[model samples]
Target: MSISKKTWLLIIAFFCVYVFWGSTFLWNKMAVKELPPFFLASIRFTSAGLLVFAISIATRKSLAITRKQLLNCTLAGFLFLAYGNGVFVWALKWVDTGFASLLASLQPLIILLMMRVIQRKKLQWKSMVGVTLGIIGMYLLVSQKDIISKEGMVIGILMILSCLIAWCSGSLFVAKADLPKNFFVATAYQMIAAGVILVIASLCFQEPWKSPLVWQDNTQIAIICLILFGSIAAFTSFNYLLKHVSPEKVTTSSFVNPVIAILLGWYFLEESISLQTGIAALLLLTGVYFINSRKRDKPVVVAKTKV
Candidate 1:
C-alpha cells in the first residue's frame, strides 16, 4: 500500500531523530576529548538555538510570549538542555560512549517513575515490569569490569543519572506549564533561553580565552556534527514527528537509540560490548516496549500545527 505524503514525511522525521540522536553519543565522546564538557555542550545548544531562532524569525513565526511563558521556558532550558546535555558530556569524560548511551537510555524509565510520583497516578502492571527490567539492565551495564576500572566512573554515572532526572523533570514541567499555543515559537524561545544560559555557564566554568582554540582537529568535526545533527536536526525532526504522529510512537525512538548507539560505538570507537551489555539491552528494550506499548484507552490526537 502506498503511504500518503504526510506519512512518508513522518517516517523520514522518525529516521532522522532515531538515527541521528543515536549517533550523537559517538560524536559527544569525540567532542569532549578536546573540548571541556560544559563548554562544548554550551556552544552546541547555543549555536542550534541561534540557528532555529533566526529561522523562526525569517519564517515569520511569532516571538511574542507572556512573561510566565518565558519563565517556564527558562526553567526547561536550564534543566533539560543545559543540565541534561551538560551532564551527558561530563559523563563522557570517564565512560565509553556506548556505556554512556546505555545509561542515558534509562531516560524513559526515569520518566515513568517521575510521572507516577508527581502525578500520583497508580503504576500499571506493564509499567512496573518495564521499570524492573530497566533497573536490571542498568545494573548489568554498570557492573562491567572495564567500567569499574575507570576512575570516576561512579561519579560520571551519578552525573548522567542526575542529568536524566533533570531532563525528565523539565519535560514534565513543560507538559504542565502554560506556554504559547505555537510549538515553533515555544521551542524557539526555549532554545534561545537555553543557549543564553549555557553561554553564561560556560563562561563562568570554563575560561574559553585560556582554553586552546583547537577547532582545527577531528574533535571540531565531531562538535560540528553534534551541533548540526544532534542538536538541530534531531530537535527539528523530533518536533516535526510530535506534530504528525502519536507521542508514544515518537517516543519509541528512545528504545531504538541505545541499540544503534551500542553498534556504532562498537564500530567507530572500537568499544567492546560484553554479554552483560547485550542482556541489559534486551531487558531495557523489553521494558520500554511494555511501558510504551499501546494503552487500552484511546490515544490522544494532537492536531497538526506549525512549530
Candidate 2:
C-alpha cells in the first residue's frame, strides 16, 4: 500500500476503535443492569468469536494451528478477554462506563512501563511526557466526576486497574508472540478461547441456567451493538492496527475513547461533564498528539518485538 492509503486506513481503524470501543462502555453498563456480568460477557465474546471464526474459514484461512499457537492464543485470550475484559465487565457493576474508561486510559502508561521492562525497550522523553500528561488528565477527569460512593468507587478503581495491567501485558505479548499469520485467524482463536472460559465462569458464578431470561429491548440492542461494533468492528480494527503500528500508537485511541464515552454518557444517560472534563479533554488530546506524532520515523519497526 502507498503511504497515503495506509495512513487513511490507519485513521479509519483508529476512529473505529475509538468510537465503537468507547460506546461499548455504555453497552456494558446497560447489559450489566439487566444481566450478570460474566453471563453477558460470555455471550458477547462467544457470538463474536464464532462469527469471526466462520468468516475466516469461509474466506479460506486456516483454522488449523500447532499446539504452540493454540497455547499462545489461549494465554492471550485469558489475559486479553477473560481477565482483561471479563473482569472489566464485572467492575462495571460498581463503576460508571465513563469512569471505567477514564481508569482504562492508564493502559498506555502500563504498556510503556511493561514494554521497557519486559522487552528492554528504551522510551523517548517525548513519549514519557505524553504519558505523564495523560495520567494527570485522568486524575483531573476522575476528580471532577460525581462521586457515587467512596467505597464502591475505590473498589471499582482497583478492579479496573488490575485489568488494565492484564490488558497491557496481553497486548505486549501479542506484539511479540508467534501466532497465525492471518490476523482474523489469530483474533478468532483468542476470542473463542476466552469466550469458552468466560462461559464456564458464568455457569459457575451466575448460573444463568437456573434462572429465566431477563432480556429487555434496550439491553438486547446494547448486546447486539457490542457484538457487532465493539467486538467485530473495533476489535478487528485494533488487531489490524497492532499488526501495522506501534502498540503505543494503537492505544492512543484510549485517550479518544474516554472522550467519546463521556459524551455518549451525557447524551444517552444524562451524565454530567464538569469544566474539568473540558480541560482534561484538551490535555488528553494533546497527550495523544505527542504520542502519535513523535519524532521517530517508522515507529512500528522499532516498537515491534518479533518472537
Model 2's alpha-carbon lDDT is: 0.76
The pairs that clash in candidate 2 are: none
Candidate 1, after superposition: displacement of residue 247 in Å?
2.1
**How many clashes (backbone atoms < 3 Å, residues ≥3 apart in a chain or on different chains) does model 1 have?**
1
Stretch of 10 with least lDDT, candidate 2: 298-307
lDDT of 1: 0.76
What are the per-residue Cα lDDT tens digits for candidate 1 across 55-90? 888998887899999999888778877787776787
Q: In model 2, how large is the Cα lDDT of residue 139? A: 76
Each model's lDDT comes to 0.76, 0.76
Q: Across residues 1-307, which tens digit of lDDT does each residue of candidate 2 receive?
A: 4579888988889888878878888888888878887878778888989999888878888888899999999999888888788888888887766667666765656666776788787778777887888878877866754654545777777888888788877776776898988878888888889889988898788555323245888888998998889989887787788889776777567567888888888888777666786777677666756665666543532211000
Model 1 scores a TM of: 0.90
Error at 170, model 2, angstroms: 0.6
